[model samples]
Target: MPTARWRKSSYSGGQGGECVEVANVAAVIAVRDSKDPAGPKVTLTASGWCDLARRIKSGEHDLI
Candidate 1:
C-alpha cells in the first residue's frame, strides 16, 4: 500500500483543470489528481522526480 500525502501544486495557483497532487513517498514520488484524491496515482523514482523538476524548471516541457 502507498502512504503518501498529496496537495495542490504550487504552480496551480488554486485553479487549474490539469492540477495534480504530489506526495513524497519513501524513495518515490506519487502523483494524483486533486479533484479525485481517492483515484489512481502514478509513482516515480526519486531520480525521475528530479529529472522532471529539472525539465520543468528549464521550460523543456510544454505546459498549459
Candidate 2:
C-alpha cells in the first residue's frame, strides 16, 4: 500500500494530550497516534468512519 498522507488534528497543539492523526488510504480511513507514528494503527471503512464522526459530534460517546 502507498504511504498515507497524514493530517494532524488542530486540537492537538503544543500542549500535552492524546494527539491523533488521520489519513485517507484508498478505500479505508487510517488513524494513528501522532506521538507514536511507528506504533499500531487502526483502519476503518468510509461509512464506519463517518458514523464514528457523527457519533462524536453528537456527543454519543462523550465521557466526562
Candidate 3:
C-alpha cells in the first residue's frame, strides 16, 4: 500500500536473528517476521503501536 519503508527492528542483529520488520503504512503499522520476509504480516493502528512501544520500553514485558 503506497511506498512504505519497511525496516528491521533495531534489536535485530546482522547475523539473522528472530526479529520483526516494521512498516508504517498510511494510518497503520505493519509487522512481519524477519526470518520470513515473504510471510504474513500483522497491521496495527497508531495508538496500538504506541502502546506496544511504550510497554516494550517500560519493562512491562521484561520478566527479569
Against the unseen true structure, what C-alpha lDDT does each candidate score?
0.79, 0.85, 0.84
Across 3-54, the per-residue lDDT of candidate 1 in tens digits comes to 5666676688545657887888777888887778788988889999899979
CA lDDT, candidate 1, residue 8: 73
Candidate 2 is scored at a TM of: 0.82
lDDT of candidate 3 over 1-64, digit per residue (tens): 4477888866677775678889998889998887887788899999999999899889898878
The CA-based lDDT of model 1 is what? 0.79
Report the number of the highest-TM-score candidate: 2
* Better structure of 2 and 3 per lDDT: 2
Q: Which RMSD values do the candidates have, in order?
A: 2.5, 1.9, 2.2
What residue runs in model 3 are displaced by over 4 Å at the alpha carbon? Answer: 1-3
> Compared to the true structure, candidate 1 yields what TM-score?
0.71
TM-score of each: 0.71, 0.82, 0.77
